[model samples]
Target: MPRSPHRTRMRLAALVFSLTLLLVMTTLGIIPRASSTTTAFSFASAGDTSTLTAGDGLNSLNRLAGSRADFFLGVGDYSYQSSMTGDVWCSQFKAKYSNIEIGPGNHDTGETNDTSGTRSYERYVAGCSFTLSSQVVCGPVAGQCYGKEYYFDYPSVNPIARFIMISPRVFNVTGVCTTTCNAVAKSPCNDTTGCWPYNKNDTHYNWTASAVDSARTTGIKWVVVGMHKVCISAGAESCNIGTNLFNMLVAKKVDLILQGHDHTYERSKQLAFNSACTGFTTNSSYVLYNSSCVVDDGSRGFYTAGGHGFLKYAVSTDRIDIQTDFAGTYQDSFSVVSPTTSLSASFTYSPASPTIGAQVTFTATASGGTSPYSFDWNFGDNSTAQGNPVSHSYTKAGSYNVALTVRDSAAPTPNTQTMTNPVSVSPTPLSLSVSGPSTATTGSPVAFTATASGGTAPYTFAWTATGGSPSSGGGSSFTTTFNAAGTFVVSATVTDANSQTSNASQQIAISAPIPPLSASFTYSPSSPLPVLPVTFTGSATGGTQPYSFTWDFGDGSTATGQSVDHSYLLPGAYTVTLTVTDAGGQTAKAYQTVTVTIL
Candidate 1:
């Protein structure tokens, strides 16, 4: 997995059970550490998210962010209701998951005739790309970017893992409304049997089936399918997709199927369909749907109803261990073993490729081996460590071999395995800073200067912003403009001559422009006589509401309020001024000339 330099590579697998489900990403302060052998990543997923049910899903996502979860998968129904500005439900998801992946549910589509929830889903969900379209992950199911149907690689680039999101009740691959994403693709609908509402005539099915099949060819070890609705749920479920869809999934050898809609947790057994299609069987058995492959039945996993918690998985090259959790408690767990299961080793260093004399941490994670394994680290330079996670430093700068050997509890001789990789120790002379105004007016350009120190000659800068753009080139600084009023996270990356990169970030808040204030007033009596009672009406525009009003009657007496009565005694060619102050403290004045005649 490619590690983000900003995030600590240390395994969060240890703090998994300690933190509550409400912890957010930033609260988990990251320390510089090393990556592990097996990628211990967990993703929190739940659907039927609405204003009412948002708290639980949010807790799950927040906990995932705080932990080492690679990414979050929202089954669907992200929002119960849609707001014009998308602040209610959309912002909640954005605040939690800037890198969220979504599948549309029934509620998200019905909130609007067209795309309201979908639009927000695409806009706020960053950190997703289709560049690895066919590399262990499925991307752009039918030529649509982050379309309701798509897939992506998670946590890291290795261990060969992928996540597929399907929107059965909402739009299909082409963004067209369909009962099931793939229902229209199936030929000769079996209305006689009420063909699976979702998989029948399903175009998404063909595309998905093809996508997963192709992904499998790219050496994927884990393939998880997520959707808003499920097929094998129990207890008179109204929208039960039934066994037809389940049959296809199990038959096609999909590792796991995550669903929402019923809002209940239900885990299926290792289940599969009989070739004759009369009935299906589960546990300790699998069906051969193809000449060269076979898959377990659906009864191997358990479920939790009412959608209270989340599910986390430990993915590796050979096996996947999943835990069904609700409220920080593990309700159930099971392991799915893959055919390619074996002991493999991999590790990463923080301040990656550190300079000589720099402290470096290494974490070694092992799976596919017998329980109670021991690790040995060999740092090529005659330095070694016995434990899995240990820190070391290289006195000289150069490339060296770093290997980890593991011995598991097997037979009397213990099964042993070794894996090695090249570790580079180089001089790290890089520092970066992005300086700009912390606050600005909306729609105005904010000038930012990025300065870099140390690290080779001929340095280059790449700038990115939350609401604007900067010209791409080699330089020290650039400028960008923001249209929306909010805190924008801007970053600048400096690439040295050797292609090593260092980045710095700045937060800028752009506020909406202050409105101009205009004040006007009218008097009840145009030609008021001395001491005659008169009424004055005051009004203002183009400013924030709840304005403070003041009326100067030219008699050294004043009154307040939108409308007030005043008397002018012995008035002649007097000017009356109405002053208005808006909520933002902006003020404006208007004058009225009035003549008071003696009665």
Candidate 2:
């Protein structure tokens, strides 16, 4: 459970200070790098960084990640998550790319055969303790967190976007990497011997579908899906045969698919995953090469690079520049954009500014797009809507940005047309509350303290009292003395930094000083046994009668009335206590002990 806002703020203050210090330290080479700034973020990636090869391929990639990339993401096989490779390679990899994000690869998971591979990968790659990886484990996989699926959003980008990572699943029927059902890599290709357990029938496929669908509806500029297994690749034998999963990504308009597994680098033209229509075969006899499904259309953009060559990507709201680098040289580069990327959709929020629980209606308008547009809305708070004109109410007060992605049409490839607007909800205005004695003697001085909440801080206070002389005043609290016995009103007005003001008044009743009261209690059967009842009588002196009595049996039970009885259920020495509240609202307490023995 989360703490109250006040407590959370206090806790955050200390953390904020620590982070600020750490931020400076990281720049000074004390701590590791953190997430990128909201303006821009770049990253490097690769798959098959197997230590078994014993080459400097990963060293070159590590240099790229350490110097130029804001972070590093692996397609899967880093050779760091497997017991076979041990922790040396993984630790070195992490040391260089401290902020690395990844999906489990076959090599990382014991060549897709050993369960320990999954456990090791989960502990190292997807562990919550990897504070630098941006490992955002949201929602559930297989009804509970398997540490294999997670998603994150970059809200600070020119147009906010989301990235999703899903685990490679076990094949429901044919135990082959979904993408490599038949395209198993040939000689010099480790894939032919073993492959990922991914299959279209597995739950992960549905998870991928649901993720891309939700990303589209949430107004994300791009849904970049990543995993360790290549769906389609070259320079490596028979990669993923997951035509079913590819088709789903294409239909959901997934903008990017980052994959690994093959030992080569190749780029496919924009194409769909429709193997049935593309005339690709599922049998290994015909689908001998990566050219089976030629990239020609905008369905599945299959790109692969071999030999530890890393991929670098510069992402933005306008365009994405992708490059495959091997030995520090660029192998291929490409750019991608949607036709509706230039389109815009904006919404106007009623009241300009909102208050807690206020119903704010957002009216959307789209431009630079064909008519009959479809609107997908993201309110920036995890909730979403689809209609052009939507109404929402917020429970908390904070500034929020609402995103509206409008698509001109559904047929063919839809473009990304986003129009964003921001709304600020103010907290329930400043409130003033004063706490002090309710009753006091005539000509006596009483002290009161005033407090303010819910508005900008650094508040100024003004105090006023009737039928009383100010003994002291100013700054949230004051002391006042009364001369006559009467009811007096004390009001406190508070003004915040924004000059907003509110006032609250409390009534103080002054009377002739009553004699101080003395409280005493007597109980029958001072030496009682277990389960025996004892009656207690409370006596008081010098105060108004018709007093209320409260008694504590000290055995986890309580009673009320001037005289009452209680019983101890267990054998023990207990204290019987009484509190007498006089008619004048004065209270006094007294206690007595009783021994209950086991009989």
Candidate 3:
């Protein structure tokens, strides 16, 4: 189900050259570059690939494809079997993935050429195309264009990352020694021409250094270098990529370094190349162990191990996540986080104990993130609002968890922060009502009662009236008397324990005071004789109703009723009196002399 690996490698090599030209065109402003907008993208990296005939190699490939990466970085060591080109790896890979970017390895160019007179390294470079969002750039040297040394900026414009691919220890198979031709040797080897090695003086090393510096000046957030030889690994492969390049990358603060010579998967702890860690030498046996330069050890999720897998990178402006996975199974993972502050939010609301139908004002405050933040609220009553300061009212009173979610304008995706707090809604507000007689007589004491209800109990009342002595009183009940007879309003305000208040007023009608009582009396005749029958009548007014009368004749006798008859036995001038008493106990008297002698 595959074609010859040789054909695949040749095509890939041509593709790399064409990609280099594309990058050059981009540099000349011939093509449109990416905008400042930050977009999330992913890629997978691995090397030492074998045919998909069986084993973990095929599964690893499937896993890389299934990851749905934007591109695949072939770290090198393609077609481990002899006579096979890159078809065993590329045929299935190209069908599954969108693009592959090659970084040449020693094995790719060590052996003899194929029947078509094409080297595997050259074939790989020509076969794999560089079609990622990043712009590919060729090496500065005239001959070093593809499969030798190159670099690219991911997301072209305002790029956050720069990837430099180089072959530090690579050699072409020569006809000097057929027996040892397959073996990779250092410069001045017995079989072939001198190989390109990793050192400060090497062309590849110089290009890599320049690329790293340029990325920093251009504001790139991350720099990753890809090579085929092992610089530091748990595998048996020596540090063939040289200590100078490794130290340079580390000192420059390169974020990640990927290589493929070692078939087993291995990742290092974050190491520093400062004076504390000491510098690495050209000794192949040197390895870093228990060094203070380890900024973060394999302890907090960052790991170091040996296995068969690939590294998947999910890159964004704020962070880069790396996962070592094989056939859908992940073995190790770590994150390279940006130093940007984390987003956080908090909120405060007015009327801590709000009643039903009361408007609650919620003001949200955010911090530690990008500017131009958006706010949203969930009132827990199935109601929602947006903006920094929002208002909401609840129909029913109860406790609810109010949530405020704030989003900032961070690149790739907006950062979000949410905060929840409990709000207790009061059942009802404090109310007061004053009740008394609707009509009252002037100068009479009127009893006014005030009733208060609702709101955190233990309420107090303040009574006030338009016309009344002691116009203000405290407590639930108040009494006031109106001196004048007119319509007066009596009001009472009740305040609950929470200091919430409500008022109610009542109108009272006061009439004028009653007049004093008076009494009058008259006899049937203008003059009456005591000897004869005398009649007297009494009446009263201006006091309460139901009057009683008492009549005293001059003959020294008394009678009770409104009208009375009396006769005097002796004829003499006597005093007669009539006393009228109203129901209110107000008495009035009237007197007259009766001539009873010779009438």
Candidate 4:
């Protein structure tokens, strides 16, 4: 059938749209593409070439390298004797596998007498560059660098997947041989004195730090650090020095540390330790995914045939899957954890300036994270405060520094921590006053009152008396009783809501009762007759003031003075009673025995 022009143009437009969509999806990593799959790589340290055959190791690496692998990582020790053997090994290595990236090993640098080994090795391997795009060499040994000890970025998978190469002997300082060499004699090349320089001026350590810092600044999500020394393993001559470099890796939070020194394959848990402490006891465990040390040979002798192998690492967006293979046999496998997404949190306390005893409410919120999180609060007063929307009351008056650390279960550790400005708890004076009965009699009731004026709301009152009961109340008044004759002191203590208290005391005197006087009467007549007046006298004693006495005779006669005389009206004997009264409303009664006889 003949297609119309208009229909043909529409079909072409649709095809263009489809291509554009495919391109966009690929760039966004949303499309399932062949390149999207992880790219695998292998690394191995082919030790001394004397006993180790490069052909066997190359064969093992070839079998381990799956179709997905893009390149290979090699650490020194390529050949034995001189750089010529090393060249032969390299030529053989290239002839067998076209996708291999080689690095300089100790043996590849030729013999101690060969001065041109370094330059020749560099020229031979310069053709095979690193797979990473951002590979750059700097410092004193910049342009002449090899792929053995360098850093690069794999942008096809992730622009931030940084791979750092480390040379075992790069940072070490060679020591002078005392027996065979003079102190002033320059150490022979390829010997310990020529390769490893431990001096601080050595650019290795500084350059390494700089590389790590640069990768961190670039927001690199994962860092794969490869070296030729096994520092974290159980046994190795350079284990301690390797530990120092390991400490640096931990400080930088590098995702994975890869190295080969011990000729055996071993793995470890992520290691965390205090750099300040040199001992292993101070080491702590971090969220380490996994670690492995691969030694192709069981014995230290590098010439062994079956001991050659390589490690295959599949780098993906999420994780770095690893598998170790020897003689084409899968020995062990593990993976590295992905980096956590960073989050930030900020805390804002309402009523920024809170007075002493005021309730301070805090609200902390996090950004760049999913909902449902936890918070840890440090009130900075030797006390811990916690909660999302937490509230606290400050009793003491001072500047309280508060910190909020926010975290979520998805994160490896706390995502964000913020310290709020010093919340000043201003000092408040508690005005106190006492009011009660100023004077009271003995065994009388008295009330003491304590009033406070300045403080926050919900004031608390505490009353303490030195010689009385201590009570607390919301109001300012406190009542008590005074029972003794001596001067009784009453005290009242008042406390506000801010927990501020004040005390006041008052003294009250209770006067004792005065004793009353007693009066007695005597008759002067020797003989008493009917209707005869008898001389009667009364004496008063023991009284506080002038005594007024009331005397009552048996015949209904009475006297109204302190002392009085009474006469008998009848011949029969009569009873007389005298009553005395004091100034303080006290009275005493006395009776005298009188006899009337007929003459």
Candidate 5:
């Protein structure tokens, strides 16, 4: 029966649609993915395993399974037996841990009498490809990964760590050195047999460098390298991993290096190449010739030669702690922490003392830890903002402790640093009070002073007056003379350094000057007797002109005019008083005594 073309087209269309949907889901992160953050996680690692059917291998597997690890790393040499296939090892491993990563060991490769297909290396690749199906392969060829060299990021989505797996000298074959080949492939032909020197320009070296550089550029907090052969170890194993690779790893500041080949477990101290030694020989017989060349002589653990144990790693954003569980007993432990986790934060604000309702800018800076960093600001006024360089305004005057917290993009737990600074906000003080005489006579100099406070210092005063000479003046104090008598107003405006202005005004009264006025009177009746009229005369001078007078007799008689007569009806003695007024409203008084007797 011929297949229906239309049906076939529909099926193809459906397949395309499904694939597109899946892609969209993955891009949007709607699909479940792995996570590798600064968050803490644990894993187990080991190499050179015997078949887990029985014996020490089973015990080690049991210990690793009980480790409560998120994943397991098979460093190399699975099943020790060259005839054992990789799938068989994975079958036993999968029962314990579903997530696993593997790097090939010498026994797993075509070394000695073992051939490529027969060795467990090829089988391990196939098994791991299935177990870790989502692993990203970056080998020289497409899908040609996990067998010899490859790299993967944990918790693939937004990973915080990268694991680089490499096989340097796993294969021993007859081949000329090439830049694209592993160390053994580039090994020097020593008389066509026996010993072979390392080649610096090899596939593993170049790939490792590129991988490490990429991880750094991508801001991966941790870079871990895993292999099956030891380079610089306290164990009896030769430095088969090559010298150039070791130095490169150290120079790159790789967080940790995991390898397993020797039957005994060993760990090297934090070592740094002094550049004293050019290269190290890979032969087992080679030993350190100079004590100065050794930075740290690390310890070794001979867990009964073929230890039945695995290494457990507790990893965090900044540190990785490792411990060995061997023969049901705790053996070795060490810690490897990244120095980049030291984080410090600081912030600076403009306008040291801000005024209420004015904007203040805060810029934050951080040192150490991985970036792209995040800034969180607590403006100290119950307000919050995020991001570097933020602005805020205070609604009231007070002292606020502004806090800035900077967090770096580290996984499992980002490095956080908090810093606090006191910010003082002052109330607006750009007001002024005009003070001077409220009443001044004509031609009198009246000092008008403007007193200002707050809103930044260095206040300037501008004075304006009405009905006064020199009506405008500057500075805090101004003096002006009033030329005419009237009710006038004095005003001053003060401006502070911040360009804030305030105004004040005072009403003043001005009058024309008055001259001295005096009043004198002469009485004709200085010795007048009772029942007689007393005559008085008054005159005045000074003050504004045209004087008027009034005279009063002490015995209750009063008279008006410049001169007046007053008589006491009955009195032994009588007093007469006269008052004079000038045009300017000035007044003066005079008094006279008269003796009055009965006629």
Candidate 6:
């Protein structure tokens, strides 16, 4: 035992490799912890690989393969040719798809010869390691597992879920008639085999039902049954085998059925069989047995199947969301309402926070009843009912818990209800101010500005000038010109965001023009002129108002009153002049040469 260290290390390495291989074989699904919410699963049916390229199939698989879902289910036919060597390919496929759960299809059994009994298939089945949680017995025969069919539990925190895989060929008990036998004349089955009954009480029926019942007993909330053949489809000859299984599962309240045999993907409404009549078309009548079943009142019993595609089931406690993706596109989807929650109601409101007196606009959303919701608003103000987002003015300020209750047209009671945090109302004073350009000149344009200091939106401005060019403008400031010579007043009225207003006024003066005069002027007649009365005029400058004038002819003639006329006595050269004075008695004079002569 105390051998070389190298030998001990080699032994340990071999043991580790063996354990790793075993782990790989046993646990096919390995997912990281972060991507648990978005689990993806992919499936392919019988004969899909023969016509579809590996790239095409792989592309479809990648699309559905979310990072969380390390598990995948290969429902059926993985190989085109049924030969012993195909098992080698299956092994290769298993190695390649180490993360998937491999299910055996008819082609994997290498039973190409239709007449070669179940010997080859049995050998292949024995070699397969995949196991089911329950076994289905063929007829009353004990220990007869339906081909290689198996069931397993999917350990998810969501409602308990289970999957059932069955071989479509083994369930094909309704034999082709080469000779006539039992019950109806020209029947397909011989007397020993019993006319392959299509009823739910048939042997194959009991076997599948037992398996499902066993799975359900384990507290599985949803049972997803996968097979190669479909009950309702547009292609292929109609087979009552699917019908029998469908009826049995409906009676047992199975959650979902995933099937593919035809090249296209298809889906049917939740279905059940009516005992009133029998036929192959969708018009055949059957008793509705499942809670999710679609009622065919017009005798159209079966809903048409979808195209070649994979079925995805999102299982939850309240409902099962089913989607069918075909050729990389989601072709069909619907939800199966759980019987327990069918009558339950729920509602929600958006933008939860709303200020009081802010008109918190909201939509009352609802589900599980007739539409056109009836709205009731309880503002926690002890005030009664009204419509959604009902505009109510809060007189007093406080935190009030708001509740919205909605009842649909078909609801027996108000099933949808929503509540929000208490709305708060706070009041504050509105204020305003004016800025810039307080004073300006008359006949010259000027501008004044005003601004709101506080409050909310929708504020109004009403400007009234006490006195200015324009006396009043309903805005912030007044712009106008003053024509008269007097003191003018300008004012601006400002309104806050809350529609509160205030006024401010400024006074401006319009000045009159000053007379320019530092000199005086006078007028008189020339000398050597005719002896007629000649008047003299005088003018003075440099004063605001109230000036005096006087006239004096050198011949001892004088006149007054700002300006006066003087008469010439004789025709001789005599100096004529006039003087003017201000109220201050500041005087100035001017003279003109004159001549008094006879004409």
- Candidate whose lDDT is highest: 3
TM-score of 3: 0.45
Total clashes, candidate 4? Answer: 18
Question: Candidate 3: misplaced stretches above 4 Å?
Answer: 1-39, 111-118, 173-180, 183-194, 266-307, 328-330, 339-599
Q: Tell me how candidate 4 scores on lDDT.
A: 0.52
lDDT of each: 0.59, 0.60, 0.67, 0.52, 0.66, 0.47
User: Candidate 3 on 1-599: residue-level lDDT in tens?
Assistant: 13234322111111111222222232233332222234477877777666665556666666667888777777776775566655445666676665788877666675433223345455566567567766678875565565567888876767778888887766662223333444445345322453566566566677788889998998888887777776554446666766677666655656677776554343343322234655333344223222233233343334544335566778887666765675433355545554446899999999887888889999999987787899999999999989979999988878999999999999889999999999998767666677888998887877788887767778778888768986878776777878888899988888888789898988999998778988888887666555577778887888888888888875668889998877777767778888888899998888888776664
Candidate 4 has a TM-score of 0.41
Off by over 4 Å in 5: 1-39, 116-120, 130-134, 172-203, 266-292, 295-306, 328-330, 340-345, 348-357, 366-599
lDDT of 6 by residue, 249-345 (tens): 5556566655443443332222233345343233243333221222223443123432233444554544545444444333544445443222233
lDDT of 1: 0.59
**Model 5: how far residue 212 lies from native, Å:** 2.0
TM-score, ranked from best to worst? 5, 3, 4, 2, 1, 6
* True lDDT of residue 560, candidate 2: 91
Give the CA lDDT, 0 to 100, for residue 97 in model 6. Answer: 43
List residue ranges in candidate 2 displaced over 4 A.
Answer: 1-39, 52-55, 80-86, 112-118, 126-129, 132-135, 142-147, 155-159, 170-202, 239-241, 267-308, 328-330, 340-366, 369-599
**Candidate 6 steric clashes:** 28
Please provide, for model 5 over 204-323, each residue's C-alpha lDDT reduced to its tens digit, 9 standing for 90 to 100. 467778898899999888887777776644446556766666656655666677777655443323233346656433334222223234444344432223234677777777566666
* Cα lDDT tens digits for candidate 4, 1-599: 11122111000001111222222232233422222245444333233222233444445545634434566656444443343444455555556555555555443443232333224345436544454444545433544355545677665444657667666453211222322222212433233543433123256666777787887787776676655544444343345234445555555566665554344443322222223433323335322212222112233321222333555566765555555555533244444533234577888887777766677888888865433677888776777777889888776778888888877655454355464657777656666677776676544456767666666555556555443433333356676554556666665666666577776666767655444466676666746666677666666777767767677877777877644555675567667787777776667777765666666
Better of 2 and 4 by lDDT: 2
* Consecutive 10-residue window with the lowest summed lDDT within model 5: 7-16
Relative to the unseen true structure, what is the C-alpha lDDT of residue 407 in candidate 6, on a scale of 0 to 100? 62
Between prediction 1 and prediction 3, which has the larger lDDT? 3
Q: Model 1, 1-599: lDDT tens per residue?
A: 22222211111121111111101111222221222237456565555544423344446556656756555566665554334223445555556555456666544544232343333444322323232223333333334446366676654555366677765534332334333323333333333221224563376566677767776887877777777665443323443444445556666667667776554343333333235554334434333222112124545444333334556766766566665555443355545554324666667667676787788888877776566789899998999999868889987768989888987876677777888878898765778888989999877878888988666657888877756754343467777877888888888899888777899988988889976889888887777888888888998998888899998888888888989987776757778899999998889999988888876
Determine which window of 10 residues in candidate 4 has minimal summed lDDT: 7-16
Name the top TM-score candidate.
5
